[model samples]
Target chain A: MNEADVIAALRALATHPAARGLRDDAAVIDVPLGRRLVATHDVLVEGVHYTPACPAGDVAWKLVATNLSDLAAMGATPLGMLLGLTLAREAVWTADFIAGLGRVAALWDCPLLGGDTVSGPAVLGLTALGAAAAPLSRMGARVGDELWLSGTVGDAGLGLRMALGEMAVEGVLLKRYRRPVPRLGLGAALAGVASAAMDVSDGLLIDAARLGEASGVGVAIELDAVPLSDAVRALLPAGEAGVLAAAASGDDYELLFTAAPAAAGAVRAAGAAGKVAVTRIGRVLAGAGLRLRGADGPVALPARLGFEHGRGCNAG
Target chain B: MNEADVIAALRALATHPAARGLRDDAAVIDVPLGRRLVATHDVLVEGVHYTPACPAGDVAWKLVATNLSDLAAMGATPLGMLLGLTLAREAVWTADFIAGLGRVAALWDCPLLGGDTVSGPAVLGLTALGAAAAPLSRMGARVGDELWLSGTVGDAGLGLRMALGEMAVEGVLLKRYRRPVPRLGLGAALAGVASAAMDVSDGLLIDAARLGEASGVGVAIELDAVPLSDAVRALLPAGEAGVLAAAASGDDYELLFTAAPAAAGAVRAAGAAGKVAVTRIGRVLAGAGLRLRGADGPVALPARLGFEHGRGCNAG
Candidate 1:
């Protein structure tokens, strides 16, 4: 069925008397006597996010990781997740998938409570729920807040490119694509330290622009300051490739946040304590547009943007 | 990719130190205030759940409804949800899909929070979250508990079969499949009343069998007492089709709960007050096996079971 029909069917079912107008970025559960819950969901389809050749365990791990990445963006701690698994009539593959999920859940302390299973084309959809101290949102940044990005960017995009045979990578970047690390603890710790934040699933520039849009502020990013992993640097065509890589690729899953200038030291301290890297990449400005500074001068920003699923397939 | 690779890709994400294993039916979130959040996810593939001609709005509505139905089965209250949207590259259809979801979320009060969008071979996934009262589960029913079902059965099944040209229907039943009612409030009300509960999704008999297995008990369903909609009754082949429809058809989304005889009155009162039908059609016993009475002695149950996606495209 077309999306329209499907949405209609869903709407008809989800419409309970008290749950009306609950369609927002997160569902609002009114806790009568306890803490509120923050929940998020995401799905990765085959031939879209990964390939048939990718290990099934890797795919399962990525599904949970990606959703947790969203919770990390919100500065929420991992609660648990439910998996909706679709197998292609292969019992062996399904067992491995579950085992893979079990391993990571054990490592992350993310337990599998329950979910549904069905046979179909191979695809994995995971819904992760986390507890919020004070629900972190992408729309809470303030002007003049120091913009920070945790960990390096563009590795996953490069990793995917390598898998697609468009680039050659010998090490970590490929691993980055296969397994992108989400800055979970760093993000959660930033809950009080940062004014606004979100994960960078889309490339940095685009996601920054979105953060700015959501926060009603402008951002000025120093192109040279953005963190680039050595792996990403080695595979790029040139130094300018950093900007290109950061701007046009996807799957970074890093946390791009804005904090008060005074809070930078404390934020970095927390990151260091957690063994996660935090870097200053830009600053939130009281303007209307995003400006990128370069080595020569203000170069024309790339007209093309980050991944948009079906829309950006031909972008590169 | 195999399930292993998929799991690997998912598990490699940044993790919180306290996150428990996240590969389960419900995500357990520590609210820090003595409140635990239980989360679950669901997806309905096109041409698998409904005909491709079904409206996109309906599909969107169904996606939320189905997940909410899960929460209802757990005796949980609505919280919020995340949407994983995969557009078909058709702007018109995508707009309609969003609109329908908007309507449902607005009506249900469960806002669509953060979700990922991708372009793919056309699939829709929605993960919904809800608050649990005391961790209701499918494995808590005791032997000798009375098995009760809310509302009529066989309507959605009959409607689906009718859509496939395998049967005939008059009214309501067709609408039931098009938009099955999820008894969220009623289900939540039964949290303290029912011993074990689950939604009637994979046919009454199969799901009842599941509940039985989960509780280490047996179920004896009185076919003569099973409630059926007038549409179902009118379409059934005289004599035995009524029982078959009740046992074999699915998509009812009604609550199948087992409660002690002492709690039956409260359940009946709650059901009536909630404006839903409550029917007692079976009882839990201390053994294993499902038995159904027929017009002439106990007849052998249908050898064919409930719908299993990808099994037979022509299966009714």
Candidate 2:
């Protein structure tokens, strides 16, 4: 089997009319009238993004989820996705990836519009297109807004540790690492409610810091308030160190956003509508940089904030 | 020095307001109100798409042009571009690529919307977005329509050979190989007038065959009517073989389309407006395959139609 086989599988999955049955080189989408188009692209390499132990389907899921997560951050409803796949000559792997792609194509209701494929190393490229009338920007956070997170922090990072055998794992940590759920519904719910929002791909603390920098405000995170899953709480290291581990670890794919304090009830309502838990972990402050607080007093910042790709996650 | 530096450089290039200063994870574009959004993606590996002899800037240009070429085929005017660049740990190469990208970003008037980059092999990915009120498709050709081609074919394929030291060469053939222009204006003009439209990225004959297949029609090419550049004409292999060679080469990025006989004048006028030469080289027929002819009689099909990436270019 070759790339043609892979494309045939994708074409079968691309059911939207905009896909043009994958016959046309480009996908033609009727932009919803008066809506702003939201677009994001992300690249994931094999070893860097996933371990060899990770399943092929999971890799496919992560690729789709991670990109849509960007759209989710912008409060955009996903319209379509385009993939640029560079694969090694492995047919079974390609077949499995296609199957995994089909699963997410339905799960998100995001059509596989069309894309280009070539033979090379395992570097995958994905672009997600979404639309929103009142899109939220990271630069829109206000000075007195409260910071919220959609899910518990550091689960995926812990899952990564489990996948790498650095820790003996029980529960679905590995699954969490492999198949992240993009908060599409929650994002759409937060569209007009949130002051600013972004997906937490690089870790909670670092992303919050970025939000603060973008909005020209300061961030103060209460370590006690950083929620941890039961499984993670049980398996974590020590007290302050463990909390830092949770907040600083990346790959969470949670929605980290800011909204006015008076809008807390509305924010919670939006969260309930999306069926995702919303936690207020911090608040926006005047000035710059990040501050951490424990019950005793202000805690010291971690030397390393999060798992940055060493460059601009912002562009992604 | 790192990814932040790269993002900072890209932020400088992305002047479009939709880019949101590259601070957000995704771009928010106002999709021209009512136009259909056209999107296409292409992937180019170092050895597969270019050689060491090809300049870094040319690769960047080719990446942008090839993706835009797909939009050109759909008769869509370009809007913006997103790049996914995976580079080896060479700063100079990265800087050069960014420079080249900036050049084409201005040359095409397509803003650097935003994209993701990572450290890996020398693989490049690009997505070009455009909009059209009445986009043409490969499947829209009708029988009796005259086939039109913009610019000479086989120049880029020959340029590739020269770049690889397979043949001695002079003139702008190498430039043609490095950076073929996308027919943006011509595609826009042909949007409603042409029955069907597509770009010839593969050899003209194979692409014509594809057009025929997609539209459920037959394509008949008159070999003698095929155009060649003066430089290529002087240096072509020989006889019917040279003409076949010219038509069977790929990477021309020329428009190969179909229009009604009555629209010939309009098509020529569109070509004049686009500042690109247009040639009538064939006709759409009632059957379902491709046929070729010379001054004397029929010409046999070549073993290979064009430079296919050995998989589903149809997806592209």
Candidate 3:
């Protein structure tokens, strides 16, 4: 099909009520009066974010997922998504990409609004709009708050290694890398239960440190208590070194949140409500900066905490 | 300084209250109870939409303005903007780009809500959010509605030729190409005045055709009535051919709208309130498509309407 046909295909998939059948230049949306609008944008570049060899469908999934993760971090429910897809000259790629977008959008229950598509090297940009009565932020943690993680860290990191053929052992790790589930349900459940919250996309340690800095408190993550997937445990060491690698790896789209000790039962109840595993991995302290503690004593921090663009980390 | 420093500099410029210091992952906004949110996104590729020779600041301005233009077309008041800037590996380029964004954002009164930036060939994507209780759409024109235009057409198109060192004549054309003023005020004023509305972005003739098609009405334009600046009169031939050329040229960020005969005075009043030059170019008639009416009689339509992606048009 031609570019117009491709665009028509996309319009077919993006059937939001306010999108006006993708005929208008813009979309008009109405949020409920009581809820505040939460908006986030993220860009995914082809060689930098995902390998060229990566399937187009997976790339589409990841592009939307990453932005939704930001919304989830704020404990917001997604309202709609707008996309700016700059694609290379390949018809098959575009067709596959649309298919992927359709599947993932349906899966996540996120309806696509309208956006621009043009000829360029692959760089997918998306803006996700969400709504929450009391949207959470990074600066809400207090001293004595217990830090919790929704899922095992570094599974996606290991998935990346597998995708690159650097590591062979696999048990749903590559899928983790390709299809990240934004912690929307867990985040919504943790809203009133948790004091502070954020998604762990750029590795646990770095995100935790950012949370600590935002709240003007110190963070102390226990290396021994850091949860690991069964696949990660089979592949890496059992203790401090293994958890360190996990903590420093990016692409874990899980909730890393904090709640008061008095709300421990409520936290577990919220976790049960969201149907995601929650583990206590750290605590908020009175001092400043991040402190890593082993079973014995304070452990030395790594040179790089997690992935920042152009840093030592290159997962894709 | 470094990349983080560049980001910090951008953080200084994008100071929307909803942005929360650009420290959080998302921006949370509370809209007025009655307003419906209007959202639009557009992407501009470096070598395609612009040139490497083009100043990064101008690129930044054009990027934000184009998206804001879409918002203006809907009779919406801008709420905020989110940017996704993909820059080449040059600190100077990034610094200049951010400066341009700051200037344009401030000029438009559209505050920046934070977004992502990464290393790639420059592909600037921006989302502009606006609010209007009863937003205008492209389908409201009736049979007897008069078509009106704001400002002059084709100045920016001529400006493109000048920027490419093709044409010799000068005066505000280059500025028009470099800095497009979105018809935000006029659009805001036209909220209840215009029956149908849209910005003339991809050329006057093509955009008129689109409006006609959307409203299921035929548009008959008197080429002689299309407004032209004195600078354009000095450079181009008089009457039909020159006006046709201007009509088929793109990059005019003017508003093209329709108003019923009964509301003519109201439309003029709205234009006066918005402080923009408004001209009655044509009227909506029965049937479909666009018809060009000259001083003598109806003129033949052009083979190609206007700039579509991958067409003969390549301004940069």
Candidate 4:
């Protein structure tokens, strides 16, 4: 299909009242009373963000999911999203991509509001709008705050290796790489309890350093306490180096939060309610920078922390 | 500069409290009481949207202006915007682009919210947010309502020709094609008076047809009454064909609206208050489709309405 036909298909999927049947130039919706609106935008390019051979549906799903993850980190409830699709001339690919987008949007209850479509290389962008009564921030973590993590990290990195044919593993690892679930419930639960929070998109160590830098504190992470999925353990060596590598991997999409030690029970309760695993991984210190420790002693930080795109480095 | 360096420069420009100094995962802002929020997203690819020789600042300016124009069409007040910049590996180009974006954003009083940036082929996307008391819509036009236009049309089309070296003229036309002023003031003025309204990004006739079609009515455009800019008039032939071609050209970015004949005085007053010229170029009819009338009689519709991208037709 051409741009017009693809737009027609998108219009059919955008049934929300705010969409105005995709006829209006903009979507107008009432922001709930006394709630602050959260907004985030992310872009996914064809080769840089995803493999060209990756399913178009997965690409679309990732586009929406990644943007929504930003909202989740803010402890916000997603309302809707606007898509910016620069498409190639492929009818089947476009249909599949839209189908995936509709499926994910419906699953998350985030409506498709409005967007613009144009002809170009495959570059998909999504801007998610959400609302929160009291949003969390990375600047609020104080010294002596306990650092917590929800869900395991580095599975996606392993999954990416498998997807790229560098490894020969299958099952949950591949799924983790292709589809990441946003921790929206846990984030909302952490809104009042957690002092500071953010999702780990880059490596955990790098993101931890960033969190500490933002809050004007330091982080001392017990490497052994860093959660790792069973799949990752089964594939990698059972040693400190293996755990460190996982900690330095990207695409985790797990929430890393900090709260006072007195709020541990409440954090556990919130984690239980959200049906996510909660692990105490570290503690905030009075100074800046990050320190990693294993069962024996402190380990020196790696030269490279995490993925840094546009700097001639691998994103995965 | 790398992504981090670019972000540092952007952080200085993002002064809104909601921006959180671009440190948080997303920006959170409180919506004012009793107001609906308007959202719109648009993308501008490097090659497809503008010529490679075009200034990066102009490209950035047009990107924000065009998206703001969508908000203007809805009669919404500009608030903030999120940028999704997939940049090429050119430090100078990136700096120039961001400088232009910051300039336009500050000029329009729209704050820079948090957004994501990555390395890839240059594809710029922006999601603009606005607020409205009672936003206008294109579905509100009634039959017999007079169609009105703010400012003259076809200047951008002529400007594009000049930019492409098809014309010898240099001054206003090129500026029109490069930097369009979104008729936000006029649109806001007509909010309660106009029955239906939209901005003409595509050609006047095509966009008018869209407004009419959305309202389930037909439009009768008098070719002689259609307003033309002095630049367009001086460059084109003095006949029906010249007017037709001008009306069929794209990138006008003028306001096309409908109001009851009885409300014409109010419409004129609103236009004058907004410091824009208002002209009656057509009228809403009972049925569907568009009718073009010349000095002699009714002229048949052209084979092609306007620029249709990615359909093997010239957008210029």
True contacts kept of each: 0.27, 0.74, 0.73, 0.82
lDDT string for model 3 (A48-69, tens) is: 8888888889899999998888
Question: Against the true structure, whose TM-score is highest?
Answer: 3
Ten-residue segment with the worst summed lDDT in candidate 3 chain B?
A: B307-316
Interface RMSD of 3: 1.7
TM-score of each candidate?
A: 0.83, 0.97, 0.98, 0.97
Error of 1 at A117 (Å): 2.3
Model 4 lDDT, residue B287, Cα: 92
Q: Could you tell me which 10 consecutive residues in candidate 1 chain B have the lowest summed lDDT? A: B17-26
Model 3: fraction of the reference interface contacts it also forms = 0.73
- C-alpha RMSD over true interface residues, each candidate: 9.4, 2.3, 1.7, 1.8
- Backbone Cα, N, C clashes tallied per candidate: 108, 2, 0, 0
Give a tens-digit lDDT track for model 1, residues B1-316. Answer: 3223323322332132122122221222334353335456666666676666677777777788878887778777665666666655366666667777767776776655545555565656777766664645677789889999988887887777766777655457767876777788787788788888888777888888877887789988888878887666767765666667666778888989899999989999879766898999889998997888766778677875565433334222
Candidate 3, residue B26: the lDDT equals 94
* Candidate 3, residue B118: how far the Cα is off, in Å: 0.8
- Look at candidate 2 and give me any clashing residue pairs: A311-B3, A311-B4
Docking class for model 4 is: medium
How much DockQ does model 3 earn?
0.70
Candidate 4, residues A230-258, lDDT tens digits: the string is: 88988877988888889888888999999
